[model samples]
Target: MPTIASSNFPTPKSWDEFEDICLSVIKVKCKSTNFNRYGRAGQKQNGVDITGKDHFGFSIGVQCKNTLNLLTEKIIEDEIVKAESFAPRLSTLYIATTRPPDAPLQSFIQKI
Candidate 1:
């Protein structure tokens, strides 16, 4: 996880906080604040943590991975597969994490 540069305190205190940070990122990236957390903890969210439309009204989705280790290709692929069930379909699905990329995202899902 990314650390706070000023306070030295962890940027996110919990998994939910991590998701919130990712949600904010999605908002800024899409230039839209219309996104929201997808579902409650333990619910079947189809691998999406936060989802909504972008400024252009294209369906956008985000999956926050608060992994302790490097984010792996397999994990991303799994999430991409699960995201297929999301309603209205997604024009873009962003995987939010601090780790470096392990593999090409386009192989698992289109426009991700």
Candidate 2:
């Protein structure tokens, strides 16, 4: 995980903050896996959070949700489908969230 700058302590309170957290996570994971990290540009019409590319030149998409409730598998499935529609060549798709998803949702992510 990217170290939260000391000046940036305290949990995020908004969608943009949540998006920043997800982007940080993605950057760290990509770097650790030897993949290049690109930042999110804008929100998708269907609310996808970020879009970029990995080291292998494969397009990547990330959707972020910050909520207290556990995420549903349908949300993940829908985000993946939406991302595919936006970037058909995407090799990796992720629905990143602040709250850990429920068991079934986690399993769905694992399968993806």
Measured on C-alpha atoms, candidate 2 has an lDDT of 0.64
Model 2 spans > 4 angstroms off = 1-11, 32-43
Residue 39 in candidate 2, Cα distance off native in Å:
11
| Residue 39 error, candidate 1, Å | 0.6
lDDT of 1 at 107: 55
**How well does candidate 2 score on lDDT at residue 43?**
29
- Each prediction's Cα lDDT score? 0.80, 0.64
Task: Quote the lDDT for 84 in model 1.
Answer: 87
For residues 17-93, what per-residue lDDT tens digits would candidate 2 score against the true structure? 88877777776666534332233456244435665666665667677777757567777677667666774466777
Candidate 1 regions exceeding 4 Å error are 1-11, 100-112
lDDT of 1 by residue, 2-107 (tens): 6544434354667888998888878898899899999999899998999999999999989987765656667888888999889979988888775533445535
Model 2 TM-score relative to the real fold: 0.68
Indicate which candidate wins on lDDT: 1
Give the distance in Å from residue 87's predicted Cα in candidate 2 to where it truly belongs.
2.7
Clashing pairs in 2: none
